[model samples]
Target chain A: MMEVSPTLPAWVAIVTSILVLLGAALTLIGTIGLVRLNNFYSRVHPPTLGTTLGIGCVLLASMLYFSVVKQRLVVHEVLIAIFVTITTPVTLMLLVSAALRRDWAIGDPSVPVPPGLPEEAERPEPLPESDQPTS
Target chain B: MSVLTRRVLPYPLLSAFLLIMWLLLNQSLSAGHLILGSIIGVAGGLAISSLQIPSGQVRNLHLLVQFAFIVLYDIIRSNIAVTRIVLTPGRVAKSGFLYVKLDIRNEYALAILACVVTSTPGTVWVNFDSAKGELLLHVLDLVDEDEWTDLIKNRYERLLKEIFE
Candidate 1:
């Protein structure tokens, strides 16, 4: 933990501490859910709680603390917000798609055959992404 | 000069966004930094233009802003809901896949919806068969499939249609 600035207002300090603690707690919960969840697909949803709100709370705390201390707006946290929101989807989508492919190959019962593909034929190889919907 | 300017700043919107992002990241507004940031911004826009990347337009800024607020509120709300599910004692969270058929065809709107849905706590977008306008999602809690469909279609998709399409 960084040293609390002596000049920082008591209220700002208190609020910052609360936000930091909250961000940490929420992130811990997310990781806990990650361990507790049963399968890959369901596991995907829990960590997002940390990514969306956990990161958000910490960034807000940083922004607020810096703005109060420096007496100028410090909003670099928005960059994280923007980048995280942009990249998380691509990363998660690709991971799930890959997992789905492996699950299909292994004949995982919980995983449904990807829609619009032939139901009878088991696809071991990756299908091209642009395949038109059969239905 | 105009030709040079056009070459330097091939995409004004992208350049402006880059410049703002640079300033925010650096947390500086000094003249030297400003000049350097502007140069980088212009260079970025020029570099991207050479790639001939496609872009999308926002038809309504007001609605976009409104939609942003709605997403913020939902993220917070869902965060709480998901937190409770995780913390409750002996509560089994039944999860399942949800299929949503979307009508909004604009690529930008679809991209935004993807981000919104994925980042929300309880829902993770798995796949979107764009050719069929069908989206498959994995949800943390399986409460009501229709309710989720209605939430996505009406809450975000409708406004996204207005904003992008």
Candidate 2:
């Protein structure tokens, strides 16, 4: 088994440290946005920020640090980036759609539901076929 | 060939991206890894065939690069600004949410926009009304809703339109 070196080059350490701090700071801002922003829709942006670029930067730093310290290419971080990029949209879309559906149900004037509900929602049950099958 | 090329890999670029990503994360050029990664990539390509995601052909790659640079700079600047506000002893009043209309409609493009907005410091993508194309965003320091709106529409949206439209 190979072990990662305990110490990193001065430049590598400095760069990684700076990146980590930058990532952390960005994450903090996202959270602040989460807290400070008003309304449900308005609040959606911050966490996406934290999860996307915030995670992207942090993951990049990790990849760099491990690659350097371990003397081997370390790159699993991209999986996270991929996952975050792909899933954020789906989760956000679901949440937004859900919120919209609730608003529509409550008759909130602001929300506009699709002709019948957005494609995702379960449709109204069709009337049971008349007892006799039509010829 | 066209079916696989156009329909299966609707976004050859994105599929290529996934391939490179698999290699990077696995951190090996071993034949085993390459074969496995290729299988996964092909499977993924096939899976997206059902999504019917609209593909945007990027014309000016240069502008897209410029947009990336701008986002990087803004993230750094906002991070510093937000940190100051959070660490300050006195509770500085900072609260604001603004609704901005969006012009882009591609689901993939919108997803990218959401990621960009959320990833940046001091901003969040709270909600978007798909039917009306209105987005509600919360800014940590709401000194100016107009400024926030301008930043998003002019700064981000313009670049995104150039890249994806």
Candidate 3:
């Protein structure tokens, strides 16, 4: 197993350890929320926690560890942070919109009925038995 | 002067950002790196210019910085709140959709607001109707509808309006 160098300062090691543990804990909590949330909309909220702060904490730890041990200013981890921060929202918006569309299509009354569609037409009745098994 | 600058660098801010990003990615501050990064930045700016994307002028840099700090603070606070919500096993969270009527009309500002809202945990930007200037957001632990509305309007929209409008 790899070990921290004895020459390295204790505080750096301590901070890194704390950051890693906090990040892992937050990620665990996020996954637990994903599993425990009752509905799909609620479930969507938890994963953002892991993606935002969870990865943020872990990346900060890595950055600190590498910069301290290498004795240099290492900040390339910020690239990942920036990329993740920007991309996560785009993907999440796409997913939420898709889910909303699916809900609308299925005529789930819980979701607001989209404009121009009557309440009865929200969920179109199933086709006759003759057209059922075309595949 | 304006015409020359527009012809050479259509998107000055984007060019600057690209240059900074290049230098950061290269992890160097040498003369050669600066020249190369500038070249890439110029090329990127010109390429984007060819797309003819509509650009909104940012009127206030101070407000932009202030808004960024507010977003960072909110993200941290929400992270804690969400962590607590997730850890408490039996506590039920009230998640619901909210419609916010927006007065800010700038597209760039609206896009940034959406990104900020969606990126923060406990809130998801679900949809927007451009015609009505209305945004649909989902909140994980909604307590008061008025509070959320005020939060979005006063906290973000006001600042965004100052910067972009």
Write candidate 2's Cα lDDT for B25-124 as tens digits.
7778889988887777777877885786666677788987897789778866775666565555565536655689999887756776786776665676
In candidate 2 the C-alpha lDDT for residue A59 amounts to: 91
Better of 2 and 3 by TM-score: 3
TM-score, per-candidate, Cα-based:
0.88, 0.69, 0.92
The predicted structure with the larger lDDT, 2 or 3, is: 3
The per-prediction CA RMSD against the true structure, in angstroms, equals 5.5, 9.3, 3.8
Q: Is candidate 1 or candidate 2 better by DockQ?
A: 1
Which sequence of candidate numbers ranks them by lDDT, best first?
A: 3, 1, 2
List candidate 3 segments past 4 Å from native.
Answer: A114-123, A126-135
Per-model fnat list? 0.77, 0.32, 0.73
DockQ of 2: 0.20
The candidate maximizing lDDT is 3
How would you encode candidate 3's per-residue C-alpha lDDT over B1-165 as one tens digit per residue? Answer: 488888888899999988888887988889999999899888999999889999779899988999999999999899999988988869989889999999988889988998899989999998777778888899999989999899999999989988998
Which order, best to worst by TM-score?
Answer: 3, 1, 2
Better of 1 and 3 by TM-score: 3
Candidate order (DockQ)? 3, 1, 2
TM-score of chain A of each: 0.83, 0.77, 0.84
Q: How accurate is candidate 3 locally (lDDT)?
A: 0.86
